[model samples]
Target chain A: MARIKFSTLTEQMFYTLLCLKEECCGMDILDKIPEMTDNRVNIGSGTLYTLLEQFCECDMIRETKTEGRRRSYILTKTGREILEKEYMRICAQAEDYRRFFSGDK
Target chain B: MKDTKRRIELYSFFDHSGIEKHLEKMAKKGWILQKITNLFWVYRRANPQNLKFSVSYCPSASEFDPSDSETKNEYNEFCRHTGWNYAASGAQMFIFYTELENPTPIQTEPSLEVEAIHRSVKKTIIPIYFILMLLAVLQGAMFVTNLISDPIDILSNSTSLFTGFGWTMLFILFAAELSGYYLWRHKAKKAAQQGEFQESHGHKTLYCVTLLAVFIGFIYWIISLIINSSYFELTIAVIMLFAVAALIFLVNGVKQFLKNKNTPAKVNMTLTVVSSFVLSFLLIGVVTFGIITAAKNGIFDRESQFYQSLYLDSPPLTVEDLLGNEELSDRYITQISGGKAVLLGKYEIRQYARSGDSDAKLPGLEYTVTVVKARFMYNFCKNHLIKNKDKTEGGKVIFADHYEKTDAAEWGANEAYRRYRSANYVNQYILCYYNYIVEINFDWEPTASQKSIVGDIFS
Candidate 1:
């Protein structure tokens, strides 16, 4: 079997997965991303659409509903696992920086 | 009323961003592109508005595919959901446009977009360029060999000059365009890796100029050939050009036809190749038949004024006319033949006067008469003669003793002479005459009889 394509998630990919965790419409991700990151992470509609398709192909996300031209997707078990792992990695990195600043070996 | 405009379509092969920018600017000018052809881009009048245009290259998007193909339908649906309206597509390029202010770009992932462009260019552009470069190299090698064997012929011949110029220009343009694509791709990839979108800045000016030059050269070459060559040659040239064009279309059509059937790509490719080869073989057969028919009809008859004047009647001067001896026999041969109306006064005749017996180890003569009608041609020939005055010919420094004489009322209006002799051979020459220059080379000093023959011919 092919290995998971993106071993490390880009900022857009991470945010896209984060938006899908709530079972959101694909187009809504474009707006929710900027709000979720306080306007710091803005995912273009194209990025959202492409990421959703790739996620579906890799079983990381599944489309839950379609209305006309709109599609809504939710994160899968695999997607949740990846997101949790990324969150833990980020926390561990912050912890190391915190310890270093506190003069702990 | 829909106002339409047509402008020549000129763009570097891989300048997607530049094309988008151009389209956006045109939209602002109230002209939106409707169609593009090999020659021109057609545009329709539209309301002036700020719009965003995006171009994406999809290598697998076959031009021959039906407009509503599943792949196209899926792509259209995806873009529509994002409010990116489908505009137009040609070959591997798909265009989208939207009037939304700050509308999302169609390609947001820079690295994936860059990779897609790279893949498309490699699939479509690289192989054609490789073939073009290979042909240019082969033609260049042949040109160099021809120049080496007979520098004079290659320089003086209009066909050779035109072909050589065209091929060299094509080679340079191909090299520049190929390298330009790769260089842009390299820069774009690096910029993409850094999470930046790099707009394509290509050799647009150089590409346009070279394309124009090549187009002009091709037209001029064809017209010159028709004007200056024999009917037979013109027929062959036109047929060759048409056959090549037809073969290219046939091959492309076969591939596209196969693709439209949704055949497996590998099998379709193989069938396209095999069918094209078979059809090409048939084309060769047709060309051969045409040639044979032309010859049978005496369409290649060489009955031009030059041929009639030069060969129908015995030459005013010949080997026998120039030299008279019972033991030293004479042999005559015509070196060059054929003429056209456009080449009226711009003509040269060369003849060889050799001993009858090759084993006898005797002297020979080379006679040349060049009628210089064109001023540039006259200057070129004069310069060539002057520069190569002491050049070795037939293992002898023939033109070493160059001298001028005005009193050649005996030979012609003016005269130049050179004479050289060695143990095994003698090469002596006098290039003299009126507006038409005559050159005579004798292996040994001309006998008294030969001297009078030269005077008689010029007179």
Candidate 2:
């Protein structure tokens, strides 16, 4: 049973979790990430495949259906919790930056 | 004739980057790699095209599997869906090529690729290379010990010397190859952490040079066999071939054992390694026993006709001549060593004597006479013994002298030759008579009269 090793989410990991909020096949997530990130981040198929395997192994994602080699996965409850925690962390950092800017003004 | 051709080339097993580059070059030249065999890569001619090749390692892939299983096929299909077409595979390595304008890389995640390669290396190359290096080191230690104890014996045994050198070269090559892969992996990991791909470095030049050296050594070894065409050499060649075959069989056995997917990979890997080691020990034991048995029944049997045949056809002075008018004292004669080849003949005899018949002749007069019939063999024996005498015989430095006679007929010898004392062991001499080299060692310094007698026997 591997716990999430990363203390903080990488951009790809965060965006991938964001896309999996709705049930989506692996290939679709690859396509959706670029559109969602405004082309700032592009996840290669190999990266997505490996990350999906790792996520499934860590119980962060579960396969809902498999049509041929195309697999559809949804974020597990554990995955949603981790994603929410990461979102809160990013929000706190943004809040600190805002406070610093206002103090300067 | 088939439309395709096969080429035999030597490449380091772990040289993924170099291999992909080479395949790409070949593709441009219209040669498409179709399959890989033990020592060759089969290729089919195709229209020249620009192709990108990617090599990867899968721990589950095996050399023993005759056909791809369902899982392997599915894996290949998965890669195909991504535009990477499977080209060839060997052991744990897989190669894929694509002509697509924009092809998805097979290994997008560097860390995962690194882990896969690590697993494959651990399962295959590392264990075998480590064991071979250990054996090479052990062999080198043995050679040093032997040279120290009996330099003369090591000089006479060229097979062991060359074998030791060959093993040493292989060990160095393996070390270079292994370390190159390790350093590449380390750098690759660091680059991957920065979201960059690092190509695996391959030692193409080192691999080529080592292979060329081995090829030349193999040819020289064969020439040596032909020059020294003795039954002993024949037996040794047979044993060597058997050992090589047994090793291949043992490796295949491990691969076949690991093919059963029911067992965990870790457990399978452990079992494969343990069994390979045990079977290798068994192989060594069997080969050693065969060699010892052949040696004992063949050369060491002084009474054997084959051993007796190496002696002189006609001797001017026999054992009886040496006894002279003195009492018989003590006499012991052993064949000691003997070999015969197409152009060379070798015979060694160790004889002991004492002035009295009692056993008090503890370190009595000992004679070690070695007779070699051919020029090459004689020269080899002479040079090695003389050049290494000081290092091999470690004791008080006594005296050394040498002389040559251009007029051999006047000296009562058949041909012109030289004689030298390596270091005073009482007396140690390397004397050439006609085409033969006759080395004589004695416990007491020989007088002029005794020297003439020995020379007369050769003449």
Candidate 3:
């Protein structure tokens, strides 16, 4: 069975959405992810470009401004809800891991 | 020294791994990627360096997009920020190279990469391939129908055989490419789900072999046409080839001219397609007019007269021979035409009085000799020949024409059949020998002695 797109956010997708929380240039997200993760999580430009387009198509992101070839985008309200759900899912996974390892029910 | 080179590469549209490795190898050999088009890839001479290459697909991009389009520029800027320099792009595919030893790959997420490639393929190669495969299937069905209904004509005609072989090869190539891509995509998607990138390979060798075979077949077909066709036929063939070549060159020229002018993709595409159809019809009209004018001027007639006189091989059995009148030898013209292929050879001889002859109703003789080169084809040749004249309507037999068994001893053959049209016996007889099938038609009822003469000559 095929999974619904973006139902479960990938690591790159999570960071990309996190970067879009504050209005930023589309190209800046490529740099912001590495800086936010301390060089741990990096997204390819091609992958980022495609993701941005897809995000815009699904209304998860919308164009805010365009200067020359550089464009800015911000996460929509729908995008924030999905991002919050993903954050909760990750938190639940972490909670489960701690409970199992720390011998706490 | 030539600073640039061009090569015809057959890499699949979705075979990014293959294209990346190939570009890397070329870079190490002192050739830097320059440009790519549907026809060929161009490379420029450069210092030998170990370069890392990546291929990424932009489904929104088109081949006719302006070189400096904002979307492409923004995409390029994004790549440049990561130390990847744009090399060249064709259609929806972009190639980027980096001097940095371990620059982040252009496509990091495997699922997204696969999706991008699939989207790009859908935009370009898939539809074209699907249309071509449909054409191949249609041609293949027609060829098989002809083979079953009129085996002798198809087996004996070089053009038919060549076209059949070409279409079959094309179908095989398309099927292999389509199936290979789908299978790879399936595996790639599975790997992508597990966060692994699956490398893709193209059937480059299959492409090369199929193209070579088709080229050789085309050359053989041309040679056969020259040898077997009349002067008028040969001229028309040459004209047709030139017209097709000119149409392709002109259409491509128009597209390139439009591209150079930075025409928008939709306008460019529409104009290109419209021009192709317009140019094709124009060429056809020109060829048809030229042929009619030449015919009116008697150019083909004079040439055919000269050609006919030069290469008239003597027929084994002639009207004079059947009539036993040596004096009639000078009255009739004997024309022979045939073609030979690997499976069989077929030749037809027609002897009739010349057009200007005083005797308009001189008895004529016509016969076709089929030499089955392979034993397996003997039965097929014989069966089709026997049922060649059967009439049908809408795939159903309306009037059944058959052959009645005749005595083989008199004709000195293993088997013989006299043709019957709706129970009326005709003067045509089909004789089957060890490796030969002969169909002879007599203008007048042939005597027993003439039948023996045909059997003696053909058997």
Candidate 4:
């Protein structure tokens, strides 16, 4: 439930959402992020809590249900849209670098 | 090659001028001073790979060193000679060690005997303070005479209080440093007890801080005494010195405390240092307070005329002529003790009668004598302070000086003294009596003098 748009995000939070492409809990999100990123991006308990709290408040993510005591979260349409925008930004920058390397720039 | 690092312990003789000299000396060794903390100088070598070194002064170490037995004995003798500012090292809280290479925070309760030895150790500055105190007493007229005396007189007068004040400061600075040390050590000790002494490899900073504190204290006192000033001035001077001093301790202590929290052993050491640091400051403050009080009250010189005037072997008392006004009355009773005499003072005997006398005479004077009573008996019915704050000044004067206009003239018949408030008749007579252990203990002395004093009033 991500609500407000942020100008920039920290490395841990950015990588956390990338891991949370599906419904996942805080620990699972932390576990998945570094595992997916080949252990490059590590999120501690505090960082995960802060980021999840912000995303939930912003309405960009929604909690589906609570299994035992842990809550699970999935991105809303807005959250996916924001994630897609970030993806495109990196893709476009990557393309520019490709052009420079291939002498197309 | 790494720059030849130079780290020196600033002893009690260290001063700002001395520190400047130290810095100057360091500069010559290609080490440039970086920052200053209370009494520490952090420096870095100008050479490549930047080898860093820190220096601080602590005057107590020489006393703390067990190697110097003669010095230790002299220090003990000095403690006997001085009052409060004696060797504080004996307080069982502070200990000293030196010539440490890569010294780390030590974890253990400082030994009681080691602390005692340290306390008995003489500070380098105390003998000088004693001499200066002597000079101040001889130049008593200089309280206001500095303007006429040579420029150096002001310098001479100011130094004693300052030196005394500086020695006083060691209590604070040393305590602060020791507190940090103790906290670190205690934390270390606790962790070590739990089999976890995660070595805090290069914590020579704590040592530097301790040394700096002692050094600053020594120098401050040295400087304070060298300049012309009063105790009041020196108080502000000491406060300012400590204020600047605290900034360094707080910053360094906080950083170290937070960083050490990550490691259980380091955390234990940190805990020890923090608690010890607090107690050290408290001890320092209390010791300094005593020093300040001494400075204020001053040490008496037996040869002075002032002492001669104040000298008295007996309880000398003066009875002033009674001055009674329409609304006020007073009798001054001064006392000079004869061989440490204790005056039970006087109690009101407004009413007197024969051995078994029971007469309801006029209420002008009506009272009873009761012995074996405490100083003040609280009256539940009267919600008021019946006595004055100062018991020595005696009880308050009622119906005198400023008699309330609404004061009643007399008491009604069959009336209890408690019935009236401010203006009761029988006018709350301030019962005055002196418990004199005479030649005989008469349960009831039917003396004429006693009767006359009470009159034929309420018996």
Per-prediction DockQ comes to: 0.30, 0.29, 0.74, 0.01
Q: Write the per-residue lDDT of candidate 1 for residues A28-54, one digit (tens) a residue.
A: 777787788997776655455556766
The better-scoring model by TM-score among 1 and 3 is 3
Interface C-alpha RMSD per candidate, 1 decimal: 3.3, 3.2, 0.7, 26.3
Off by over 4 Å in 2: A1-4, A15-42, A62-74, A89-105, B59-66, B246-347, B350-450, B457-459
Model 4, runs deviating above 4 Å: A1-5, B1-459
Give the candidates in order of lDDT, highest first: 3, 1, 2, 4
- How far in Å is the alpha carbon of B210 misplaced in model 4? 13
Which candidate has the top score in TM-score?
A: 3
- How would you encode candidate 2's per-residue C-alpha lDDT over B1-459 as one tens digit per residue? 467988985677767887899899999989989998776899999988899998887765655443535435545665676778889887778888999977767776677677777877788688888888888889878888886765445544446556766777787888888788788888988997886778766777877877778777667666655554354555568678788888878776675556655454456667777787888888889888977886776653434333332233222333444435333323433233543433444556544443453554433233344445445666555565445333223665445545334444433555433444553233455555765565555555555666677777776
Docking model 3 quality class: medium
Model 3, runs deviating above 4 Å: A1-4, A102-105, B302-316, B324-338, B349-361, B373-376, B387-416, B420-425, B432-436, B452-459
For residues B183-216, write the lDDT of model 4, one tens digit per residue: 5445555664454532222234544665566567
Winner by lDDT between candidate 3 and candidate 1: 3
Top candidate, metric lDDT:
3
Global lDDT of each candidate? 0.68, 0.67, 0.87, 0.39
- The window of 10 residues in a row where model 1 chain B has the poorest summed lDDT is B338-347
Candidate 3 backbone collisions, by pair: none
What local lDDT score does residue B350 receive in model 1, on the 0 to 100 scale?
Answer: 43
Q: TM-scores of the models, in the given order? A: 0.72, 0.70, 0.89, 0.24
